[model samples]
Target: MLTMAIVILLLLMCATIPVAVTLIILAFVLGYFYSDFPFYLAAGEVLWTNSENYTLIAIPLFVLIGEILVRCGSARKAYSIMDAWLSWLPGGLIHANIGASVLFSATSGSSVATAATISTIALPEGRRLGYSEGIFSGAVAAGGTLGILIPPSISLIIYGIFTETSIPKLFAAGVIPGLLLAALFCFVTIVCSVIKPSISGQRAKYNWKTRIVGLFSLMPLFLLFFVVVGSIYAGLATPTEAAAIGVLAAVGIAAAGRSFSIAMFTDAVLGSLRTTAMIMLIVLASYFLNFVLSTLGINEQIEALFSGMNLSALETLLLVFCIYIVLGMFIETLSLMVITLPVLAPIVFAQGFDKVWFGVVVIILIEMALITPPVGLNLYVVQGVRKRGSIMDIVVGALPYVLAMFVLLYILVIYPQVALYLPNKV
Candidate 1:
């Protein structure tokens, strides 16, 4: 029965069915066939109650902040500041693409939005500067994944809600690993450029004075990041409240940049609404699927299957890693996470793994998923903005960063403290 369900899911997703509809159909199918009770009746209640969750309110607010940044020219400004500081690196503007992404991720807290915002700003610049378009777009896609790994991440918030974990602690834990993964990406770029300097764009060295002045331009972003992420870390605001505050700060930044108006704000709100609606729909459907599976005793089946393998905890984790990598290749990163967590979270806890640590590891996997081929959302995002190249260029470019993620994953597995230290301090 489980195998049949998996086949149906893979087929539906492969056939380009919308994920929310796919999940809903799969849930109802499972409930109708396998359960003695009329289980589909509970879906409406499940969705409604979950939709009303206060923690979930943060999604729209974080999304609004990203939309405002994208619309108001703040994202472009942030990119330029990164260019001024980092364009002289061996990989030239490639570093800036990543630096800007890291900065943007702090505020956006979303992978797709970060990719869209940064790629829109950086693609033309990278193209004109003579950087290899493939690598440039690839770098943007990879960097955008940081949006979910960094604090104030929408993915982390969703994971917290699904697993009943501490959202603040999850945020705190992601800080060090997220920054480290970003630094590792830089190192990969530098190494790639050094190996084949021809792949790099024309390098430009800004004067110390201009660079110094550009530092002030970054102050606004810093303050925005601090306001959004800082408020949470300081225990002064909940994630939802911090997201609300960030929305205001984003509007202020837009207004200061002379891009604010009723029309612009309305557009941002609409974009936020569209993105949030899609996310909420999938989330609601996933919650129902989770409920259906629970009522069907899928957890017991999963435990039985793992026990039949007689694998140690480490071996079980390795298998889970393989599952994510394979599933990631086919499923959209966000949908894959939302759907699979229902099954995988129980496995993680059963292995005596710390929930917060596992959350960070899961995010790293999601980051890998964001760059992989076929369904990598960021690849399409970057390619969409570039609009002139085969997305395979992005796939090729992002391939190297996958190695960096593997390194980060290996480090966390070997040294769990890397993810745990900040959370513990918190």
Candidate 2:
């Protein structure tokens, strides 16, 4: 039954059907063939429970905040401030791309929104400054993945809720690893620039006065970051409430900037609704499918298979990591997490791994899913922003960062403290 469901889903995906529809179809098929429950009743229950999730409210709110920042020109302002500080590096604007993305990730929760926001602001600058499409687009796609790895992350919240871990601690744990990955991306950009100077543009120099002046424009981002993440850590707000705070803060910033016209506001809200609806549909369907699979004893089958392997804890984890990379290639990030977390997380915990550390590691894999092929949302985002570049350009550009992610993954494996240190100290 599982094989049939996967095969049907794959064929539908190959036929270019929408992912949400594919998932729904598979859920219905599985419900009919694999369970005694009526298909309609099962589907309705799944949809209802998925949409009624209070925690899931964070998804749309965070997305709306990101959209407002983009529409109100706050995204550009933040990028400009980052550029002022980082544009003198070897990769010039590419380093700024990474830096700006890391900053935006601190506030934003959606990787696609982060990629879209940064690409809208930074893609033009790369072209205006004659930077290569490969590196420029690649940097935005790769760096934007930080949205899920940094604090105030929607992904981590979902993971925490699913696994019954502390959301604040998960958010805190992501900080050091997120920053480390950002730094690694910058380092990779510099190394690439030095090796192939043709991919880089002339470095920009800014006086201290100009740089300091630019910093003022970044206050909105910093404020939003504090309101969202600070509220979580201070125990003042749940992750959902923090998301609401972020949305209100974004609106205020847009109004303050005089960029909040009715049209822009409407567009931001609509974009948020559309994205949220799409994400919710897939999430709901995945839950229904997972329910059916669990009832059919698929989870037990998987656990039995793993138990029979008799592998060491580290070996079991490495195997799970390998599975995530393969699955990530074809699965959407949120859906992938929702489907696998219930089944895989317990296995990891039973192996004596820290849930917080595994959360960070899973986030890095999710980040990879954003830029990987066949279904890489970030690749399509960067591609949509550019009129002339091939999708291959973005994929090739993200390859270096993919390797960087592998190295980061290995480092985390050896030294779980990288993820655990900040949360533990705090």
Candidate 3:
């Protein structure tokens, strides 16, 4: 049954059906044929429940904040500020790409938004500065993946909802790993630039006074990140509450930049609504599919099959990693998470792995998916911004960062503390 489902899903997707619609079709087919109850009716209830989730409310709020920042031009301003301080690094503006992504990702929980925002600003600048297309575009694509791994990540919030873990802890856990990934990205750029110095262009020259002045521009973002993530850590707000605070802070930042306007605010609201609707559709469809699978005892079959293998925990983890890396290539990130987490999370727990640790691991894999070929959304987004480059440029550019992410995965596997330490302390 599982094999059949996979085949049909692939066929449906190949036929150019929308992902949400494909998921819904699969759920209905499984339920109608395999289940004892009317799964469609149950689906209505599941959809209603998921829609009412206060925690899920964080999705639109964070998306709205990101949209507002993008529209109000604060994102570009923020990027320019980051460039001033970081362009002096070995990789020159590439360092600023990662640095800006890090700051923007803290506010924008969506990787697509982060990539688009940075690409819009960074690509033209790279062209003007004589930077290598491959590395520059790659930096934008790879750096944007941090949007999902960093604090206030929509992915972490959804992971928390699915696994019944503490969202705050997940946020706490992601900080160290996210920053590590950023540093690794930077390190990759530095190493490559040192070997082929021309690939990065000259280290950008900025006066110390000018750089110090630009440092002040970072304060708004820092304060906003602190208010949002800090509120969660200080136990003053739930993740949802913190997200609401983040929205307000983002609006204020946009206003401070003198970019906020009524028209921009309207566009931001519409953008948030559209994005949220698309995400909720997938979430609801996946939830319904999960219910159907559970009702038909497929989940139990999966559990028993894994148990029968009697594989060691480490071996099981390796197998899970393989599954994600393969699945991630074809599916959108959020849809992939919603579809797999229900089945995979339980198995990992059964193997005695920490869900919090595994959550970070899964996010890393998802980050890779965003840059992987064929369907890596970040690649397309970045390429679209370039408006002229071959898509291969984005793919080839992001490849090193992909490798860096793999190394990070291995490190996490060896020492789960990279993900668990902050959560444990908090």
Candidate 1 lDDT at 357 equals 96
Give the backbone clash total of model 2. 0
lDDT, candidate 2, 1-426, per-residue tens: 657876987798788887778777876777778778776776777678767878888888888888788888877887888888998888888988888888888877778888988998888888888889997899999988999998878789889877888888999999999999999999999899899999987667789999988887787788889988899888899888998988899899989989988999999999989988887777777777777777777778788889999999989998999989999999888878987897899899999999999999999998999999978989999899987858999899999999999999999988989899878975
Q: Is candidate 1 or candidate 2 better by TM-score?
A: 1
C-alpha displacement of 129 in model 3, angstroms? 1.2
Clashing residue pairs for model 1: none
Give stretches of model 3 more than 4 Å off.
none
Model 3: worst 10 consecutive residues (lDDT sum): 199-208
Error of 1 at 196 (Å): 1.0
Q: After superposition, how far is residue 372 of candidate 2 from its true place, in Å?
A: 2.0
Q: Going through the candidates in order, what is the number of backbone clashes in each?
A: 0, 0, 0
Taking all chains together, the TM-score of candidate 1 against the true structure is 0.98
Clash pairs, model 2 backbone: none
TM-score to native of every candidate shown: 0.98, 0.95, 0.97
Q: What tens digits encode model 3's per-residue C-alpha lDDT throughout 1-426?
A: 887788888898788898899999998887777767777777768889878888998899999989987887767877887788888778899998999899889998989999999999999899998999998999999999999999889999899999999988998899999999999999999898898899876556778888777778778888988999899899899888998998899889888888888989999999999999998888888888888888888888888888999999999999999999998889889888998999989999988999899999999999999999888999999988898969998798899999999999999999999899999998
